[model samples]
Target: MAVNLNDDLEFVDDDYFDMFEFEDEGFEVNRLRREGNSAGPDDVEDASKQKSDTSALEYRKGKDMQGIPWERLNYTRDKYREMRLKQYKNFQNLSRPHHGLEKECKQVKSGSRFYDFQSNTRLVKSTIVHFQLRNLLWATSKHDVYTVQNYSVMHWSSLLQRGQEVLNVAGQIAPTQKYHGSSPRPLSRVQISTMAVKDNLMVAGGFQGEVICKYLNQSGVAFCTNLTDSDNAITNAVDIYQPSNGSTRVMTANNDSYVRVFDVERFVLLNRFPHSWSVNNTSVSPDGKLLAVLGDSTECLVADPQTGKAIGSLKGHFDYSFASAWHPDGRILATGNQDKTCRLWDIRNPSQSVAVLKGRMGAIRGLKFSSDGRFMAMAEPADFVHICDATSDYYCTQEIDLFGEIAGISFSLDSEALFVGVADRTYGSLLEFNRRNQFHFLDSFF
Candidate 1:
C-alpha cells in the first residue's frame, strides 16, 4: 500500500515520456479516465491500425526524399555547359581579325605611316590678312566665305589657297555727285559686330544697331535699316533663321535690352521683345521655335522665337554668360560664361546642366557646334580654343594655340575643316585646320 509512485510508473517507456516532456511538464488524468471508460476492444484495434498506416506513409516519404532528381540535375548542367560554349565562341571571334578588316587596317597604317605626329603641322594655304576679324559666315553653297573686320566685308573663295580677297565692301559709300540743294549727312563708318549669310544674301550688324543686307555677287547694298533709335546702340549678335517653307527672318540682340526679328527678303520688321538686361548673344534653336539667349544676368533664358516670351531659364554659371550654341539636334544648349566655363544644358531638363566644360584663360567669347554636331569649339578671350568631341559626351578635347586673342570660330558646312580668327594686331590671321582621324590604340606597337 505504501509503494513509491516513481516505481509504479516504471511501466511507461522512457523515450515515449521524453517525446511528450515540456519545460512545465505536469500530468492531468481527466482525459485518460474518460478515454478508458469509452474505449472498447474494437476501438483500440482500429486506433492501432491507423497508427500503422501513418507510420507507413512517413517511411515512404523519407525514402522518396533520399533519392536524387536526375532529370532536373541533367537539365541544369546542360544549360551551364551551353552558356560556357557561347562565351568561348565570343572570345574566339574577338581574338582574331577577319581578312577584310586586316587588309583595311594595313592600308590605313601604311598610308599614314609618314605622317608627322610630333610636328602636327600642315602646309598653310590661306592667310586672311585682315585685323580684328569679328565674325565669319559660311555660305550654303560652300563656295564663298565672308568675314567682317574694321567695318568692312571681305569675301573669299573657299577653294582659293592664298584666300585672295574676292571683294571688299567698305562701311561708307560716297555719293556720285554733291547735291546743289541741302544734302543729307553722309553715312558714318559702321563698326561691324555680327554677320550671317544664307544662300546669296549676307546680313551684317553694326555697333550702332544697323542691319545691312547685301548680295554676295552684287556691288551696291540691297537693303539697310537702323534697328534702334539710340545713337550709341550696339548690336550684340545676329542670327538668320531660314525655315523650310517660309521667308528668312533676321534676329538681332542689341544692347538696348531688346531682341528684334525682321523679314530679310521683305525688308520689314516682324516682332521685337524686351528683356530686363542687355542681350549679349542669341541663337535660334534648330527647329526655329525657341531662342537661347545669354544676357548680362548670370542665368540664360529660353524664349519664344516669334513672340519673345520667356519660356524657361537655365541657371548655373556664377558670372554673366556671353555666348551660347545649340546642338544640331536642338535638344542641348551650351552657354559660355565669364567664369571660364561652358555649361551644357539639356532642354528636356532645364533645372541643371548636363556638363560643365572649363577653359584655360579668359571668359568664353565664342561658342559654335559643328553642322553635324560632331564637334564643339569654344574660344576664350585670348590664346586658347577648345574643340570638344560632342559625340563622345565631351570626353575628347583638342586645344589649338594661336598665341593671340580669338575673335570667333567657324566650321565648314561639311565639318571637314575648322577656321579660327585671331584678333591680335600683329599676328592677326585666319587659321585653317583639317580634321584628321586618330588611331590612338596603335601607339602600343611602338
Candidate 2:
C-alpha cells in the first residue's frame, strides 16, 4: 500500500484539513470511540449507540434522590434555614432594652418621667396546671412573696435578681379520732380561697369552710379549724391586723354572710359579725378602730372592729364591690367594684364617694396602697393595673400592662417595690416593679 511515503506526504494548506472534519450530533461518538471503544468500524457504531442510551439513563437519575425532585429538596433546606434565623432574631430582641426591663423609664401625661422596673418572668412548675391565683401576700421581709392557688400556698423568693419558687405548703386533712358511734368522713381536700401573712405566721382560708395556719419558718401546720357548719362555704378574704394595745388577730370575710375575728396566738374565734350579704373583702383601719368592708352591695360599710357595729356606709358605686383598701392614716378608703371603677371614700363624709377612678377593661378585682400613703394601685381582672398618686387627688397616674388575669396586687412595706400576681396557665408570673425617685429625703427619715 505504501510504495513511497515521501510522495504521499505532500504539503497541504491547514484550512483544507479542517473542511474534511465532521460536527458531532450524538454524544460525541467519535471521542468515546478514541478513549475506550477501540473496535472495527461496524462494532464501533454499535458500542456508541449503547453508550448513548446509558448516558440518557444517568442524566434522568441525576435530577432526583429517593424519588424527590431537586427543586423541592432545595426549597425545604431554604425554609429550615429561614426558620432558624428568625428564632435567633427573636431571642436577641428579648435581650434588648424594652418595657419589661427594670431600668426602663416611661413618660407620663404630665411630662414627668418615671422608671418602671420589671423582674424576670417567674414560673411555678408545679402550679402551672392551675389557672386561678386566689390570693397574694408579701411577707414582712420584703424579699419574699406568697401566692395561693388551689390547695397550695407558694412562697417566692426575690433575693436574687430573678424571683423563684422557694417553698410550697399544700393542705391536707387530719385523720379522724376513734369514736364509739359512727362518725362522718372529714374533707379529703381543701381549696384555699384567701390567704394572709404576718411576721412568721401564714393563715389561709379554704373553700371548704376551713382555716389553716402555718409558720413560714417551720414545716408542719400551726393550726387548722373548720369555721363554718357547711362544707360549701367560701372564705372570700383574709386579713392580718395588729392592734395598738392588743396582740395580732386575723379577720376573715366569708360567703356565708359573716365576718369573723380570730386570735392569732390562741387560734380562737373572738367575734363574728352578721352582714346582710356575702362579704367579698375586709380591711382594718390603720388606727385599729374601724373596719372597711365591701360586699355584694354597691355601698361600703364602716364597722367597729371591737363591737362589729355598723358605724356608717359610703355609697355611690353603680355595681357590686369586690375589693377594699385603706389609707395609712385611716382617713380615706378605696373600694373596687364590678362597674370598672374604684371609689374613694373619706370617713368624715359617709354619704358619698370622694372620687371615682375608671379602668380600661373588666372589673376592678384588687387594690393596694403604699405604706407611705403616697401611691394607690388598682388592678382589673385582665391586662391592666393603675397606679395613682394619692397626693395629687389621684389625678396623676400610670398604667401598667400585665397582659394576664390579675389575681392580686401588693406594695412592699418599705414602699419601694410593687408586686403583681398573674393567674394563667401559660403566662402566670409574679411581676416586681421598683420605685425610682430622684429625691431621698423621705428615704433617709424612714
Give me the runs in candidate 2 sitting further than 4 Å from their true place.
Answer: 1-115, 125-134, 161-171, 174-187, 439-446
Evaluated with TM-score, which candidate comes out highest?
A: 2
In order, the Cα lDDT scores of the candidates are 0.58, 0.62
Which tens-of-lDDT digit does each residue in 199-235 have in candidate 1? 6777777666677766666766666667777744667
Q: Number of clashing residue pairs in every model?
A: 0, 0
Which stretches of candidate 1 lie above 4 Å from their native place? Answer: 1-143, 162-186, 243-245, 438-446
Candidate 2, position 163, lDDT:
36
Residue pairs that clash (backbone atoms under 3 angstroms), model 2: none
Candidate 2, residues 1-446, lDDT tens digits: the string is: 00111111111112112111223223445665667656567666665434322121233345211112225333553453354334321101012232321122222243222324435243431121111223555545567777754446667676643333333334345422332332223444665566778778887776556676677776656666677875335677788898666689889887678998887666667899999887878999888988988876767889898889999988776566778889998899988876667878888887867777877665677888898999898887655778988888887788875444566777878878787776544334566676867762343342
- Taking every candidate in turn, the Cα RMSD to the unseen true structure, in Å, is 37.4, 29.0
**Which 10-residue span in candidate 1 carries the lowest summed lDDT?**
114-123
